[model samples]
Structures are given as structure tokens and as C-alpha cells.
Target: MNEQSLNLDSQKVDETFFTVKLPEQVGLSDQLWHLSKLYTLGIALSYTYVHTPFKCPRSYNVGYFETVIEKSKSILNKFTSINSSSTDKLIEFIGLDKHELNISDQQFELCNIVEINIDEILKDDKINSTSDLKKCIEYFGLYSKEKIYSFVTKGIYKFESKIEQIVRSANLDDSTIKKLKLPEKYWKAKEKFSGKFSIDNSKVKITLHIRKGDRTCINLNGKLVSVFASSIKVIDSTDYRDELKQSLMDTTKAYNLIQEIFNKYGEEYFSVQVLSDGYQRTFFTIIWAMVRGKIKLNLNDLKQLHKTKKALSKEFNDFLRFSNISLVVGESKQNLFQSIHAIVCADILIITSGGFAYWVHNFFRKSNQPSLIINLNSCDNKVVNKISKFL
Candidate 1:
């Protein structure tokens, strides 16, 4: 890892060349954002190195699957770094035509997969700052801290070649990547609508983005207070049962919002898009759907029910039903770009406004789309009224 001359502290880390240390475990989207942030910081300093994404955490195990993207291979190579010589090599290396049913065998055959040396990375004092690329600037002794701060705050991040390469390199099907790279016509509201399902180009697409993987009341409290009050007010926020109860209530309201849209648009006039972690909500939706005779329960759902706790899932399901979800997109950290593309395409987004939701909101803001943020801890009818206008 230390073979590169630029890795030394005395030499001053290259201002134009910065290396990212991928986390052993991190949401893929978060990792991409960090990469983009570092790359943007480097561009401000005029770095010339090809912004290459490291094929890291070589064997990331999430849920029930894993894969290894070759190191130094550009995900966006096909889209951005157009070199006739490298294109043939990357295609041959990726082996897009090869299919293997044995996952273990494929992982074993991965030739370049190697663990990163965290010790070398941590020992370098010049690489210590995670903010404003301070460690990099200090190591190189290039710009003042003030200058770096300004770039960090004001730098514009567009869907440029660097990011395109990374997204192209993600562990996604070639078809999806190709579709994403297609002209804007493929993603426009009218062009992307489904006609057979009765979806029309004129319908407003509403995406209900649900995420609660690592949420806590403390975070929600701060967000709600900031949006609704002038100052922070102390309330008994540590009621675990109440927290779960409020989640159920908020979910019901979310379902009601979908129903309201359906009523207004006659189901054919509007479309519902769902982006969820899928554990809690999926469990509840399945149970409710079975009750309403909309869908029959299957063995796999039964297994998940046993795993997620049948009692709580049953209670939550009692009030919520999956009426007309046009599309339900699962959030897989491995396919961050696909999730991002879907989120960006939505006409209206409904989210919780923190954690992953906060990140999505920023993306939407960058693209100039409107969203409704629900603070579940203290969500009120007023928020619902505001959302109704959008419907």
C-alpha cells in the first residue's frame, strides 16, 4: 500500500491526488457521497490523477448476497473515460457475458481482491482530517484553511464524468447502467410512464421513501424542534414503546396519504413509488394485504414474520394496508446509484427528513424537486394538510 511515492507525510500528500479509505461496513450511497466530496475537494485544488474508485471492502456481506468489483477498474469508464484501448480491456475484465450460479466459487476466483492496510492509513497524521480535506491540504501545505472552507461550502457537484464512472462501476446489471446513461428522454416523466397499468404521463409520481435502519428518538427530536419551534423544548422522549407506537401511527398516515391520492386521481391518474429498507414496513404490509384479500401470505413471509416478531408485526399491520403501490424499490447498499436515480426522478418525495432521508432531501434540493418531510415523533395533521396540497 505504501509503494506509491505520494503516500509519505514528509513529501506532502498530493493536493491534486487524494485517496479514500472505504469503511469495512457503510451504506454504499454514503460511501459514494464521501468519495464525491473528496473528489470535489481535489478538483478545487487542480488535481490531475484519474479519480479512480477503489474496489474496497472486497467482500461486503449485506443481507444475503456479496460481490467483488475489481480494483483500479473504473465503474464509469464506459461512460466517461473513453479510451478505445481501455474499453476492450475493461469489458474483457468485467466478463459481462459470463454467468455463474456458484457465488462461493466466483468469490474464490477473484484474483486481485486484497484487504486494505488500515494501520498505514491511520498512522499518517497528514490523513487525519475528515473535514474540508484538511489532512490533505495540511500535508501538501497548499491552500489556507479559509480557502479550503470556502471550496467545501460553495463547490458545485454535478453529474460529471468522475461520478458517472463510479456509478457505472457499481455492482449493477449492465442493462440498468446503460439505461441510466441513456439520454434524458428515457427518464422524463412522460416517457417513463406505464400505459398498460393505466399510468399516464400527466400523473404526478409520489415516492414514499421509508428508512429506519439506525434511527433514534434523539435525532428525530432535534429535527422536529428545529422545524416547528423557535427553540428546543424538553419533552420525555425516551419512551421506547411510544416510539414504536408513533412509528405505526405515522405509517398509517402515510398509507392514508396514498389512499387520498388514489381517491383524487382514480388510481389511473397518479402513481405511487415506494423506497423502503423493507424489513418493518414489508412485514406489516404483507400481513395487512393478506387480511384485505389483496395478497395471500406465503411461506417466505411466514419465515420473516417469525424473525421480525409476529405479535408486533400483527399489531402494526392491523391499521396499514398496501393498496396501490405502483412500484416498490428495495434499498440495497450495493446498488446505491440505482436507488439515487429512482429518488431523483420522483415528482414528489415524502420522507422522514433525517439520516438517509436527509441525504435524499439534499439530492432533491440540488435537482430542484419538492419534498414533504414527516417528523414521526411529533407529526401532526398540519403536515398532512400541507402534503395534501401537493396531491
Candidate 2:
């Protein structure tokens, strides 16, 4: 059958149809963000239904995109398609799955499917900012601010639940289950590849999220030195060193930060879990310098020593030997989500000044759960004091 024969004839169809294509490929987290944006846009536009042609290449990981997409489709069904009687059924009835529609799709000339330039739509004066793709969604004009918020919130919850399920499925052993059940008691690396370490539990649980990769850094004599873009630096004097001190909280500073939290919330109430690209080798390079005593343990140096594989692995492991503080380092997307989920559920949460940190901070804030977001981007003690008031 020809593509034109599938979709309804534009002149006769009662409902308007439009679609927003997802990026060709992206990380699972990024993909979910896009889907949420698309959902928001569809609800705003009064479009018949929003469609996504999300399919991964055979070479890439399969479950990452497909699993989240399935969960999103389920959530969309709740607000949109109720039964086979819905528009999805209409599309199927007309035999349209085989054809992929784009700007030049012949189907657009005869049917309701039409090319929509998001840029043109976003140029409207009503949209105040185009900084975020989600910001532009409000211009669709299909729903009010209240309705859009409700739908997007629902979508986020659905995706979060799916991520939790993925983590649960990956963790089937007793050791992993024990850690998840009482994370505070078993503050060790969750992934089997990481060497085991354990310590006593505390009264409070704080999840730390560190985002690395693509951030500008200097390779000094084979050692990695993280340089924050916002901080002022000088080639001579202690400016660069001092700036580094403020930008990242090293092991001692991290310990000190936790102690401060302990002082406010009570020593027995606080424990820590780290949600990051734990085993990512490149991110851990700075830890090499930390272990060698070339640099202090700071935010950029954060990551479970056991999860990483570096030439100085033994030295890093030895450094962890005497440490009283222990944390559960996230291994996968599901594991990371579980930590984030716990952070959202916990009475107290702490985050740094990284992009992912801000992302998590925003999540809790929108959920109406006020959290302690320490801007590690700057070392000013006032920032700590500001966080204390939140606690």
C-alpha cells in the first residue's frame, strides 16, 4: 500500500496530526528528557497524537532506548489512547507503521501528516526563552501551564519507575539486595567488578552526583587537573591551586562537609551514597594524583576507588583501606536511578555543583522536597552556611 493511503485525508479528518522526531541517538537519560519534552508539546498543541520513531541500531545497546520508550508509551496511553479505539488504532487501521515520515515524506502531500518546523513555532513572542527545549513546548498552545505540568510530572514518574525496575533486575544476588535494602549499613561498591569494602551505618543518607566528561581539564605531566570554567586562574602563584581547592571538595573536605552535616542533623543520622559514572576510567584519572598525594581529594576526584581500573589501582585500594567513610557507588543507569530515587525519598539530600547535580536538585525541588544543594563550584563558606539553613 502507498504511504498516502495510510493516514486520514486532511480535508476530511476531524483531528489534527503532527509529530516531533527524537534525536537519532542519545544516552538513555537524554532520551527520556526528549520524550518528556515531546509529551509536553503534544498536550499543548491539541495534536491527534505525538509519535516517535525510536529504534536503535543493532550494534548499540537495545534495552536502554526500548525499555524507556515502552514505559513512556504506557504513560502516554493513560492520558491519551485508552483502548484500540484510540488514534493509534486509527493509524494501524490505515496500515502506517511501515512508512517513516520526514520532511520529504510523500504521505504529507495527501494525508494529515505535515512537516512542522519547531524553530518557526518557537519564534512566537509568547515564548520568553529558547534556552531549553522544554521551554519552547509551552508555545504549542494546546494546554495551560497547569495541565502541562501535570502531564510532564506523570511522564517523569513513569520513566523513573522503569529505571528502578531495570536496576532491580540487574541486581539479583543477596549481597546486592542487602545493600539496596540497608544502603547505609553496606556502603560499598555495588558492581561485582569492584572490590568489596564495608563500614558501619549512619543516621543520615546523602547521595552525591558528580558529572564529568567534556569538562575542560589540563593534563599536567600525565596527571589530570580539573579546571572549572567559571573560576579565575593564573599560570603562576597559588591562584590556580587555591581555585582548585574551592572548586572541588577533596576526601578531607568531603569528610569535613559530611561532618558539618552530621553536626547539624546529628552524627548518627548521616551516611553517603555516590551516584556517578563510577567505573568510567577517564573520570578516575585525577584519583591517581590524589592517591599519589599530588593533589587533595576533591569533587573531581570523587568515585569509588574500587570501581575504577587504573595503573595505580593498588595504591587507590590501599588509600581506601584506612578510610572510615564508605559509600555505595552506582554501577549502571538503573543503579544510579535507585540512588537518585532514594535521595528523593530521603528526609535530607545533598548535591554538588555539577550539571547532573543540578538536574537531581531540580527533581527534588519540583517534587516539593526541599534539599541541600551545595554549590561546589565555589568554595565560599557562605554557600555551606546557606545550605545549613535548608537543613
Candidate 1: worst-modelled 10 consecutive residues by lDDT: 222-231
Highest-TM-score candidate: 1
What are the Cα lDDT values of the candidates?
A: 0.39, 0.39
Q: Which stretches of candidate 2 lie over 4 Å from their true place?
A: 1-14, 17-20, 24-38, 48-204, 213-253, 279-326, 330-334, 360-370, 378-391
Give the per-residue lDDT digits (tens) of candidate 1, residues 144-225: 3211111111111332333334333442222331221212322332233334123333666566665533331222222211
The lDDT of model 2 is: 0.39
In candidate 1, residue 56 scores what lDDT? 26
Model 1 bad stretches (over 4 Å): 1-15, 19-21, 54-61, 64-200, 212-239, 260-269, 280-323, 327-341, 357-391
User: What lDDT would candidate 1 get against the real structure?
Assistant: 0.39
**CA shift of 349, model 2, Å:** 3.3
Residue 128 CA displacement from its true place in model 2, Å = 8.9
Error of 1 at 18 (Å): 3.8
Residue-by-residue lDDT tens digits, candidate 2, 313-370: 2222322332333444424434544554444444444454444445433433333445
